[model samples]
Target: MAWYMNSVEDLAELYNRVKEKNIPIERVSDHGHAIGIYIHDPDGNGIELSYEMPASEWGHDPSGYMIGGTAKGRLSGPWDEALARQAQVTA
Candidate 1:
């Protein structure tokens, strides 16, 4: 449900094209260097299109990784133990 447009003008043009086809667009907004649009697909699921931040803002930085048991506050219950023991599987 996401897309990237290099510039605002391209985003606007695409919006107009869809409008010509009588589609329903809920809203559009600018998020700093990126822009996002919200709409409903024909089946009514929400959809989002976005232009991502410049590549400089993204890279391999392990500092952002969250320790499994530390998420959602201190792990104090059975669910926490299950999460901690989950196999190291990646999708």
Candidate 2:
């Protein structure tokens, strides 16, 4: 189960809200141009919330299929939250 978000900032906001509500997030990761949040539903079904970077930032193979790389540096937590807030303000 998964849902795609529009931007990293959107994902950040969702993450903050979910945390505020005491929802347990299993994990968070960055997959190149995208970020993913893994969580479980009340029924214990796995769910993933994803946010992809803009098309301009995406990498493509020769055949034009999108390619993703492993995350570099931190993907979530206070630093990301601060960045997300700044992005929101700028946007």
Candidate 3:
């Protein structure tokens, strides 16, 4: 999915709420400190909600791509800046 969370605990709670409401989740995974959760919306598009830190040693990045973090060896893209910021603000 294009957007997601960065905290497993929060994602877990959300997942439970949706599931309790009769929503079905496609799958879930634990990528170290990150938890990847997926669900298919009514239109059949797979949406993913996850909790993973940015791929950077420092806390913030202006260029949107800072290296050196736990996700190093994992094949993944840089954290979406807008998505990350939204998560932070909402949290």
Candidate 4:
């Protein structure tokens, strides 16, 4: 399952809080149009916590389905709280 968050900062905060609880998180990864953290429920059901990238950065297939590439080398840490705050002010 997948859950969407508003921004990278929001996702980062959630990740930090979840981590402090000692819940096993699988990994953090980028999916082109989003960043995600993979985890499993107590029963082992897969879950993804994700933050969608801006629509301007999203790509689509010929059939109009969103097609995202892997972001294996992208950084996922040290979210710029300032940037998020700026965005909120401008938005």
Instruction: Report the number of the highest-TM-score candidate.
Output: 2
Worst ten in a row by lDDT for model 3 = 72-81
Error of 3 at 91 (Å): 37
- CA lDDT of each prediction against the hidden true structure: 0.53, 0.69, 0.56, 0.68
Ranking by TM-score: 2, 4, 3, 1
- Candidate 1's TM-score: 0.51
lDDT of 2 at 40: 91
Task: Give me the candidate number with maximum lDDT.
Answer: 2
What lDDT tens digits, residue by residue, belong to model 1 across residues 28-60? 544433556677889998887655455444333
lDDT tens digits by residue: candidate 3, 1-91: 6346555456657666767787776555545446566778899998887767554533346767543333432423332333355457769
Model 1 misplaced stretches (Cα beyond 4 Å): 53-91
Predicted candidate 4 versus true structure: per-residue lDDT over 1-91, tens digit per residue:
8888888788888888877897877665555566767889999999998887777566566777666544332435543343345457769
TM-score of 2: 0.65
Error of 2 at 38 (Å): 0.5
Candidate 2: tens digits of C-alpha lDDT, residues 1-91: 9999876677778887778888887766656667777889999999998787666567677787766544443345433654455457769
lDDT of 4 at 46: 94
Clashes of each: 0, 0, 1, 0
lDDT score, candidate 1, position 43 = 92
